[model samples]
Target: MEEVLKKFKPRVVSTGIKELDEMMGSGLLDDSTLLVIYDASSFGWTIGVQVFRRMIELGGFGVITSYSFPISLLEKYALTMQYDFLRDGAEGNLAIVDVIGSIYNLNVNLPFVYYPGSIDSETFLAKMEAVYRRIMKERADSRKPVGISVTVDALPDLFGEDVAMRILRRNLLMKELALMREERERPINILLLNRERASRRFIEWLSQYAEHIVEFRSTSISGVERMIARKSLLPSFTPSEAEFRFEHGNIEIRPL
Candidate 1:
């Protein structure tokens, strides 16, 4: 029998937690997407913020599509770590896409525009693609590998029941687009979903697009939860389970 060759893909993004990385096949593969399901009391927001901070440290670009809370909250979260979130945003290292500000009737004074109303699937995808391209162009001179991290915070909550099905359908399509837009091996896509609030059907469909899945389970005890992290690329992987806490600008994932 003849042996077949496989192309190599590097793992460029790290979860910043040593144990979690060892469990997740040495962090996420380059150009791969991760789906994170977090409960109300878990550290979902911490995961997203850390990814953004990593991008900044690497001199890479990031896009954060906020559908759950104001980007200001993320900024405040970063402040605890002694990070100047506003300075980074002004330098074009990160772009915050505020999708729910207008819908919630809050006056957001950011350099970017907010949807301010119900957002459809089409518009959301377009805005994402545009920000991605703009960032890539700005960094063309550096000729660095396009390391782009996209974080979508609480997707389903962005729309109404009337457009629920449409959003799901569009999400399926967006996943396809994400797979198609891999220019070189340098993209990191992250989707943070509120598992308690997300429908099972929606999750089932979205999981199809995720290369890695990390689920956070809340416990009866406050401020502590369990994390089950797995990688799809490694079929032999036994999901690593751990108890973690997101506090004081740090995430600690300890073996359960």
Candidate 2:
């Protein structure tokens, strides 16, 4: 037991929330694909935005991908917390992979943002890679880019489930392969999924791809919700629920 223990030294990348860090066994594991399952009505996306914000602050190029909304809304989101989105983007610490905008062939207006001229799993992934390469090339000291995709459930509804699954599978495969090869340090991808909008099978598939899972459920009372670490690769992780509220630009998570 002593010999085994000697070889075990765990480390984590801080998520910027101390209590949440404890819930996830110190903090988020490196190269972790974390799934954030949530209901449609809850303030689920807030959790993801916090992670993205921290990633940028920590010198990781942060990428925000939204299938449910556009860049305009993301700008509004930064305003909610009074975050320094403009400065981060200007410094290349933040970027956006506008999936919806890319699908519609919208013109780009930001240097830190990327959207493909064509729509397909190949082009989409290529553009994401382009963003990654560009950031790392320009910022030699920056960490691997971390990303958060809001409302992954919308992908299926936007495209048929079959196509969306294919896209997801391709994305997972790419990330896993890169991680396995040690080409670069893989990023923490926080994917927010609204369970009500996706098929059961799709959620199951999502569970298989992620290294960690955080599930959120809203109560009948307005502005109150519960979150739990549903699944995790960390040995210290334990299943427990914590109630939280999103009000006045603050996230109040109460201990049970």
Candidate 3:
């Protein structure tokens, strides 16, 4: 285990929230899978963009699979969060797969498919297979490990608990398949927004496939939030209480 860790020293990527990053010892690992649980109003998109931005800054590619936000909305939010959308090489490195978009747009540049917001599991699975093939081809042609962010907002509305579990399971399996084929690690980040159907059993099952789990909660302090990590692969260190603040977005330790 120590040998493997040393060989694959975890890379930390900040979430743009200082307090959250501090709690996780600088940031999340680059090649590991992470699950982010929060509500729509809980700054989930903000965190997702931050992770994508970090990947872009590192000259890496990322994919955002949005089940709720439209492409236009995602673009708007990303720009609002200070991401430069018009910059050269932006589209080349960042790919947004908006299921809300028309199917015609899927054939453009990247191999993406649109779901049209109304589809059965079988149909959805077929479209996903095409997308997966395209992604693999793209990665092969570009020879870059892509960071995939799959945001399934209001999951319960899309599929039943059993169906959702199956979808998620297949997604993770597909990621692993890509990882093996590319001879590179593909980090898949899942954002479950306000998904009440996601029971503890489901989460526990998912946890086995995840390397990190980040839970975000809002605080009374303005511009501040609390983040907790259920699992991590980093060296442990005691945090000082003075280092944390409610408004300033700092994470500090205090006497219990």
Candidate 4:
């Protein structure tokens, strides 16, 4: 047991929210995939902010495969998160794989790669593969452990409800993504979605692939929201919920 533990070396990575981190047993296990399911009443935006901000702060990197927003809006996200998107891009700390314009046939002008065509699971997987290879090659000599947090922002917003459902049904893409993350090592992926928009079947299927499931909802107390988390691997930690207040560009997870 001691040898196995030493070989695997439990390296926990933060989500950038201290209280939530404590709830997650001091942070998530390296390479664990966290899926964020949020309704309109919840503070879903903080999902991206916390994961990537912590990754960048740790001298790691972040890759955003966004279908909801373009590069311009992403820049605003960076400013809101207090991180520099362009500077991070230049310094090899960020990569954006854009699929926003593809859904609407608009030519998006951005420094990162853009797939300006109809999106499907195949297209998403191909673009992600390319992005990962690019990051790996560019940081071949770095000793930073190749830790990267990938955010797949608002999938339903990208493919529309029916198409997003079909794409989500593609189990091959999820399997391939899992394999790729393990092969690269320390690749933590956070899949964000609008709970009210996406089908329940799709969410259930996706949850099978995710190591952790985080659902956000509104609370009775005004100005506060709830985060219900379920960990697949950590059985001792049972399902728990946390309350948070989102204001002044910060999310403070309140103690229960």
Global lDDT of each candidate: 0.61, 0.76, 0.54, 0.62
Q: Residue by residue across 1-256, what tens digits does model 4's lDDT show? A: 6654453564676776676666666666666667777776666657656776676677766666666776677678667656676776666666666666666676656454435356465586555556556755665335233222223335655556566656655634664555444444456667776767667766786788777677788868887777777664554456777786777677677656
What is the Cα-based lDDT of residue 30 in candidate 3? 64
Q: After superposition, how far is residue 147 of candidate 2 from its true place, in Å?
A: 0.7
* Pairs of residues clashing in candidate 3: 240-253, 241-253
Please count the clashing residue pairs in each candidate, in the order shown. Answer: 1, 0, 2, 0
Pairwise TM-score winner, candidates 3 and 4: 4
lDDT of 2 at 235: 83
Write down the TM-score of every candidate: 0.74, 0.87, 0.68, 0.76
In candidate 4, list every pair of residues with a backbone clash: none
RMSD of each: 4.7, 3.8, 5.5, 4.3
Which stretches of candidate 1 lie above 4 Å from their native place? 1-12, 80-83, 102-122, 139-154, 160-185
lDDT (Cα, tens digit) per residue for candidate 1, span 227-256: 787555654456788887877777777876
Worst 10 residues of 3 by lDDT: 241-250
- Return whichever of 1 and 4 wins on TM-score: 4
Model 2, 99-214: lDDT tens digits are 78877776568787766456664465667667666665665354767888876888877767888888788877776565445455557788988888888999999998787788
The TM-score, computed over Cα atoms with residue i paired to residue i, of candidate 4 is 0.76
Tens-digit lDDT track for model 3 on 141-179? 443344444455334446666787788788767765654
RMSD of 1: 4.7
Candidate 1 clashes between residue pairs 3 or more apart in a chain or in different chains? 102-116
Worst 10 residues of 1 by lDDT: 1-10
